[model samples]
Target chain A: MLTLHNYFRSSTSTRLRAALNLKGLDYDYKAYALLKKETQTPDFLARSPAGLVPVLELDDGTALSQSLAIIEYLEEEYPDPPLLPADARGRARVRALAYMIACEVHPLNNLRVLQYLATQFDQDDQGKAAWFNHWVHQTFRPLEALLADSPETGRYCHGDTPGLADCCLYAQIWNNRRFKVDSSPYPTIERIFAALDELEPFRKAAPPEQPDAT
Target chain B: MLTLHNYFRSSTSTRLRAALNLKGLDYDYKAYALLKKETQTPDFLARSPAGLVPVLELDDGTALSQSLAIIEYLEEEYPDPPLLPADARGRARVRALAYMIACEVHPLNNLRVLQYLATQFDQDDQGKAAWFNHWVHQTFRPLEALLADSPETGRYCHGDTPGLADCCLYAQIWNNRRFKVDSSPYPTIERIFAALDELEPFRKAAPPEQPDAT
Candidate 1:
């Protein structure tokens, strides 16, 4: 059996959950409360040395961390309803798009980062909001430019089907809304995100729909 | 012919260069002076919408952005000297290790982020160094634990052979030294890094050896 250790509201967790749903795979959900520091517990740390969420544990107890890595593992092992393109260049483009968000945007503005900003810099709520919005805009502008101009963009970030990039885009858009980031500047992203929201897998895997949602 | 548009000192660029050397592929180097904002030019931006360095341009005019994505593309195109392990679980483990540094550590402490801290938050030199060192340590500790404890770890991060994880780890360690991060705590990382430094591909890819290095 596949079991996932994740938190409902964490963007990384949501990405993994959406991927699982899209792959039609069933997993046991072992949720953590990030706000309560549940991921830092000794047992959780043993399972995930990074003390981050969305770890996938196999039937034999081997665990995988990093949402993108887990999703790629699923792609390699499952190979149906493909999340990546078959062509090499196309696959590169999709992975680049996903990393543009995953590596560039989300890491800088996630919960732990925001907490560090608050504690170390004495950033007030308004300051935190500004920081979040600033990075969202910085990353979104390039993303908008990429999606708006590229012919590869269809109903989703890459094609008509929702894939890895779509999963990341949808999760990021959801997080953007939480911080009240202005989506008016990114019509392409807004459109793709809208399309992703209609998909059953995305809807079912949303943060609010999770069993651990508050 | 392969052409790489990259800045010498950029960690991402160094990672790509090392990967290319590891695969025994030759490329034309189009050096960029990042301090002069060469990456922001219209032509460069046209190729890499993110306006980031280390874009690998193929002979067909296709430009691949994101260092990891480019490396994956190379791995797919050139199977010999495989950067990823053969098994799905092992590949996932390697990718997770790479992402732990790429996504968690490097993103938080890169040039643009440091500039943001300095300008927006009015962080002094000491403050920026503190921020850089803090994140390096924050990431390195768990990494050390994972590498030191994992049975999979050999002479390098995964096996005796250098692969994707080692490329990232070597690049990050080089950057860590720039900020004067104390490496004494991570003997495993230090030992692996020392091993990597002795390899020809890694040595050839060091920042100071590049044409653009100051």
Candidate 2:
């Protein structure tokens, strides 16, 4: 069986869960207590050197780190119920949107990055929270405009079917709400989330629905 | 012909250049002066909302953003040189290594992020330089250790052949030297860089070799 070594609240982990469920793949969920820093331990570090969440361990004893990489691998190996768009151009667009969140927004607010800010810069909890929401709001505005105005957007971020961009959008929205980000400006995003909420796959993949959620 | 909208010194742009050269693909280079903040213009933002460089426009008039996405598209479309390994595990491992540099390292040292610390946080040139080298060191220590101790690392980062990981590794090393980062501590990394520097494709893609280089 495929085992996903993940943390319930991690946006990275959330991405994997949504992808897995959407692709109709059955997997075992193994949660790492991230708040307690279980991810930093030697065992988890051996599986993933960077010591981050969403390490997907395949049945053949292969451990894949990085959520985007793992998702792409799944897409490559399992072609049905495609998570990405068909054409190369569409794939690139979907990937670019995903990177906008993965590379630009999520990294800045990750637990490790936030911890570094707090420890190195002497930022208090309030300052840390402010830092987190600032990036979220900055990215969300452009995303909202794109989803609301673009011809490509349908029930999801890309089209009527749920795809790669939707996977990222859903996970990030969950993170935003958890942080109490004012998502009022992104009605399109809210509408898309509502659309995703109606789907059993996305709902089943929610953090609250995961085994590790307290 | 494919068109690359890029900034000469941008790490992401450098990444695309290396892959394009390695694939022996011809591209029309349209240089945008990043220092002048031309990337924020409405024209540029239409293709990439994040207002970043290294957007690849294909023959079909479809634009691709994000360096990694562009490279992957090239790898998939033109399979002659085969930038990725054949097996799924190997592919996942290579992609993970690529993300270790792209997501974990380069995002922390991008031009916009550095400028943000300078203007927003009152960090001076020295402070910014410290910030850049800090991430390089933090990521390089583990990267060097991974390369040095692992038998999988050969003349390049992954295997004897130049692959996706090498593309990312070379770009980061080239940027590190531009900032006058001391690379003595990472002997294995230095050795790999020396090997990569000898390659014609890697040589032609170096920042100083670019047509728009300052």
Candidate 3:
């Protein structure tokens, strides 16, 4: 059994949950309130030094931090429904797409970064939303171009299968809705998000579907 | 032969270069001046839709984007000296350590992000450096703790051999020097970085050694 320590609204947590559901792996869900700084506790910090969400605790008490790393661990350990592609090039493509969101968009729009903006720069809600949308569009523009132009993109960000990139893409879309970011400009991304939203695994991973959604 | 498209000072580029050097792979280095908006050119954007540097052009003209993804591809295609450990848990540990820098620190302290603070928020050099150091220390504290306490850690981030995490750590240390960040607080990181610096593979990949280095 695995114990997942996470918050509902965290896009990274959403990614891990989607991956877990897709793998058909059952786990114990433990919620932490991000707004109240619950992850800043000594216990949580002991589990994940960074004190971020989606720490997958194994039965042996081995805690895996970082959503992508955990998902990769699951992929390797389980290997039943692969989140990455078979070939090296294909896997590279999927991981690259996943990184675009994971490394670019989500990092900038993370709650901590947003709080930094508010505290350090005196940015208000409007200013923070602007900052969020700026990064979202910056990466989303190129992401849409890559996905739309590639012959490799099928029902998901990779092939016909829902893989690593789709997990990131699906989670990001849910995060995007909070700012009311218009997806009309990215038809390919919009289509893929729609397709992913239809799937039970992804839908169940949505923020609103989580136990701690508030 | 592979063509490495990158900027001399980009930490991501440095990561890729270190990986290539470690793997004993030869590549034709193609420099892009990030400050001059060289990567924003139509030609470069065609190669990498994200308009980012360190695109690995394969023999078949396939351009791979994202430094970590490219490194993973190199590890898979040419497995002579494996960059990742053989076990799944080891790989997860290495990748998590790498992502702590890649996803958390680098994204926030990137050149463009600094420029954003300058242009959009009226931040000067002092402010930018403060911003840079803030994110660096935020992650480095836990990173230092993780490295110091983990029995899995050896000469590098995972085990005695240098691998994925070392590449990220080495590049990040170089990036930190630009801001003149004090590394003394993290003795473990300082020691690992010093060990890596002594190696020819890592020494050759330093920013000052790049062809287009200013």
lDDT of 3 by residue, A1-214 (tens): 9999999999999999999999999999999999999999999999899989989999999999999999999999999899998999999999999999999999999999999999999999999999999999999999999999999999889879999999999999998999988788999999999999999999999999988898
Q: Write the per-residue lDDT of candidate 1 for residues A89-110, one digit (tens) a residue.
A: 9999999999988999999989
**Model 2: share of true interface contacts reproduced:** 0.51
User: Model 2, B1-214: lDDT tens per residue?
Assistant: 9999998888888888989999999999999998898888999888777677888988887778889988988987987797788887677777877888898889888877777677656689887888788888877877777678777788887778888988998899888987889999999989988999999999988999989998
In model 1, the number of clashes is 0
Task: Give the TM-score of chain A in candidate 1.
Answer: 0.98
Output per-candidate TM-scores for chain A, rounded to 2 decimals.
Answer: 0.98, 0.96, 0.99
Instruction: Give me the overall lDDT of model 2.
Output: 0.85
Best by DockQ: 3
Enumerate the candidates' DockQ scores in order: 0.90, 0.60, 0.92
lDDT of 3 by residue, B11-59 (tens): 9999999999999999999998888999999998988999998899999
Inter-residue clash pairs, candidate 3 = none
lDDT of 1 by residue, B1-214 (tens): 8999998899999999999999999999999888899999999988888899799999999989999999999999998999999899899999999999999999999998899899888899898999999888878889999999999999999988899999999999889889999999999999999999999999999999998888
Error of 1 at B16 (Å): 0.4
User: Which parts of model 2 have CA positions greater than 4 angstroms off?
Assistant: B149-151
